[model samples]
Target: MTSHRRPSSPRLGLAALACGAGLALGGCHAERIVADSYPTTVAQRHPIVLAEGSTRLDLPVGAGAQGLTSRQKEDVRAFAADWRKNGRGPIGMMAPAGAFGATAVRSALASAGVPATQIVSQRYTPAGPEEIGLVKLGYVKLKAQVSHACGLWPDDLGSGGGDLYGATENREYWNFGCANQQNLAAQVADPEDIARPRAEAPIYAARRQTIIEKHREGGDTTTGYRQADAVVSDVAKE
Candidate 1:
């Protein structure tokens, strides 16, 4: 018995060659096409930035008011506390020239636990008649903010300006997720949280001891609720 070997078809060989050439051409075209595909992620496009900025509070003074009002005192206290936490330079207090609230502002800051040496008192000419009695307090502090400006439309979202193929690539536009990034930056309490995590807080030693003792005695280790009604549940109870 003689074995017959089948010859390869020329048409099949030519078809394979054409297919490979087509793929190669497609890849070259893909590389040559100029697509603005940088900053693939929204975070990369609009990153959060930490920078030195000023925090300000304005307290209005009435004609006959002797000192800061109750509301003004609260605002000043909060401002002082925030300054102690994040501020680096001295806290600045600017009051209108000949304003009666100048002394009150200093007293309020001192009452809020701010050192008298750390407060810098200054007087400024009022911009207008309405601002004659306004007291401005501020401090320089590090703040977290978005790097890019929001509400910008550099590129057309629609298939215009020779970007039809780019639109079809399913890539995000230039201003995508900008508002979200800004919101995230604004919501961050500390600017350092963006750079790195903070040190772990100390554990509750008393709570840990209680749990451990309960576990050793084979008693319930879970937290006991004195008022059962405080717990929220949708299931029907017996």
Candidate 2:
């Protein structure tokens, strides 16, 4: 028996419902919760998506297939910026000796605010005549990337083959949460913050001592009520 099936977008469905119910203003928020069931969703992954590691850019010869094209120049700048954001240590740039745009690539790296001293240059030689030349980019950083592959609709949704919950309630498939999780991973600036939080701000010891003294005499600890843009005490006294 042939079964006709139309793919369902959980996000779009929630958006339509929100609009019909006159909740168009807060509709975007409602849409966000529709697919977030990895921990809160029906379908989940084993290792989860947040556990991340190093990512590398095996720089392809996309620009002109010569030294470095404008596109390649931009790529170097972007790569350096990303490296400075999280990854530390010396950055490496490998280019074939006779490549067309090596100077342009070096200039781009400098433009990206990377100190030339921090970069270690290496001569790249092709393995064979047929092999295309490429400038490799790599760095170690705490990357919050997806651990699983998406678009994994194992059984046909229409036929109602596998688990009964999906067919009866029309729930999402296993890979439903992967894309949103991947997006969340990509948006994060500091991935190490996920593993451990940053140190807290320093405390005001003088203020604490003053508050303690006030409390001993049964006085209110709250004292200062300065407005924003207030002048310094020395300037105000003058």
> What lDDT does model 1 reach?
0.82
Tens digit per residue, CA lDDT, model 1, 76-120: 999989998999799888777777777888888999989999988
TM-score, candidate 1, is 0.71
Candidate 2 regions with alpha-carbon error over 4 angstroms: 1-81, 98-118, 124-138, 165-172, 198-201, 204-210, 222-238
Query: Where does candidate 2 have its weakest 10-residue lDDT segment?
Result: 31-40
- Which segments of model 1 are wrong by more than 4 Å? 1-31, 34-36, 62-65, 127-131, 160-165, 210-238
lDDT of each: 0.82, 0.66
Pairs that clash in candidate 1: none
Supply candidate 2's per-residue lDDT for 64.
Answer: 47
lDDT of 2 by residue, 11-70 (tens): 989968867766545433432333323342633452334553564555556334545556
Candidate 2, residue 68: the lDDT equals: 58
> How much RMSD separates candidate 2 from the native structure?
16.9
- List TM-score per model, in order: 0.71, 0.47
Which candidate has the top score in TM-score? 1
